[model samples]
Target: MKKWLKYSLISLVILLLIGTSWFTYTFFIKEYETADENVDNIVDTDFEVELPDTLEGDLLDKNESTDKNVNQSKNESTKNQNSQGNNKETSTRNKEQRDTENDNSKSTNSKTQTKDNNKETKNQTSNKNELTKENDNDDQTVNNSPDESTNSEEESEKTQQDHVTAEDIKNRYRPTFQALQDQALAKLNNLVAYAYSEYKKKKENGEKVSYGYFYKKYKSAAKELEAKTDATFERLYTSLQQDLVENGYSKDEASDVKAYYNQKKDERESRMLSKVLDKF
Candidate 1:
């Protein structure tokens, strides 16, 4: 090979090498600068989003207002709950006070009724004592009379006549006395029948009938029957006494007849009361 040709070939190869290096450096440097600019833009946009000062102030004010509204709503709810609790406490207190007042009123009423009953009973006792005193005074006046000796003689004679004529008086007046007794027994039967019916009605209605209550009712009825019969006997005795005096019987004998019939009435009343109350 020629020296000149070799040298020319080497120079051409060196020129080609220099052109490739320059092209590579220019292309790589431009691409790297573009990538760095893109990274900087992403960092600014994604990591630190900044607003204008006026917009930021408006957002801060809106957040503070929302927090204040929430606090106000919570406070209002708490106040309402406290008010309801206070109202319930007041209502309970009022109810308790009313109950206490009612109880006190009932106690006072019961006491008043007791006082009235006691006063009435005292008055009745005083009246009965006065009546008994008057009766005793009248008996004393009769005993101290001027004709006392004559009355004693007459009473002794009448007693002797009463002993002799007792059976005759009974035979003459027994039918009338028996009729009166029958009427009294009929009245007692009516009362007993009514009371028994009431007792049966109470039992059928599922009411509890206490023995004491029924006994008291029957006892009261018996007392009423006795009182009414005693009054009737007194009236009948007065009429019979007049008839006996007209028929030549002594006053003492007529009085003995009255006494005997009165004893029979008492026995009948006691027996009827015991039987009726026992059935109840």
Candidate 2:
């Protein structure tokens, strides 16, 4: 080969090498710069959203506030329920107390009424017992015949049927010891009345009869009765009061004697229960 030809070939090769290097540099430079710009844009816009952090924080605060308001409303409702329950309990207790007081008052009244009824029944029973004892005290006839001793049971039965309570202490009277005592007392009391009546009569007739003069005559008559009787007038009068009904004195005769000694008192109370009774 010629020397010049070899040199030319070498130059051509060198030129080819330079051209290829230029094309690759032009294309690759543009691609590298575009990648760099894309990297910058990703860095600027990465991890960013449409909604701001400030706005998200406001939404979270609003949600928390709403939850707090609901909780407060629930607490207020619970408090109202508790208050209503307490009020109902208080009302029930008050009603029960009133009922208890009423029951106690009714019980007290009932006990008082029961006691009164028992006392009345006891008084009636005592009066009946007294009458029975008086009837069993003696055997007597409705006649003043003390010397005639009759042993006939039939006659005694007939006499008991017509015994005592006879009017006017004359000869025909109950031949009991009580009746005889009452008869003697009646005679003395009648004599005392007659003595006073005679004094009044003398005073009305303008006689010189003072209280001393009347009392002297009354004592003289009392002395005569004392000498004729086995017992003194004072002793007999005391015995008559203590042993009137118990010594076979009739109720009518005893009542007459009592009328002379005492005044009638009030009537007895009733034993009926109360009209209004508790139903509960």
Q: Model-by-model lDDT, in order?
A: 0.59, 0.44
Best by lDDT: 1
Per-residue lDDT for 72-125 in model 2, tens only?
655655565566556556655765675576556657776667766566557656
Q: Which ranges of candidate 1 are over 4 A from the true structure?
A: 1-172
Cα error, residue 231 of model 1, in Å, equals: 1.3
Best by TM-score: 1
lDDT of 1 by residue, 1-280 (tens): 6999999999999999997776655443223212223222322221111211322344356546555655565565556556655655665576567557655665777666776656655765676577556556645654454344445445554554444343454465566666777766766666676667778889999998755455554555566566766766666667556555654676666666677777877777787767676766
> lDDT of candidate 1 vs native?
0.59
TM-score of model 2 (CA atoms): 0.23
Poorly placed runs, candidate 2 (over 4 Å): 1-8, 17-51, 55-59, 93-97, 100-104, 107-280
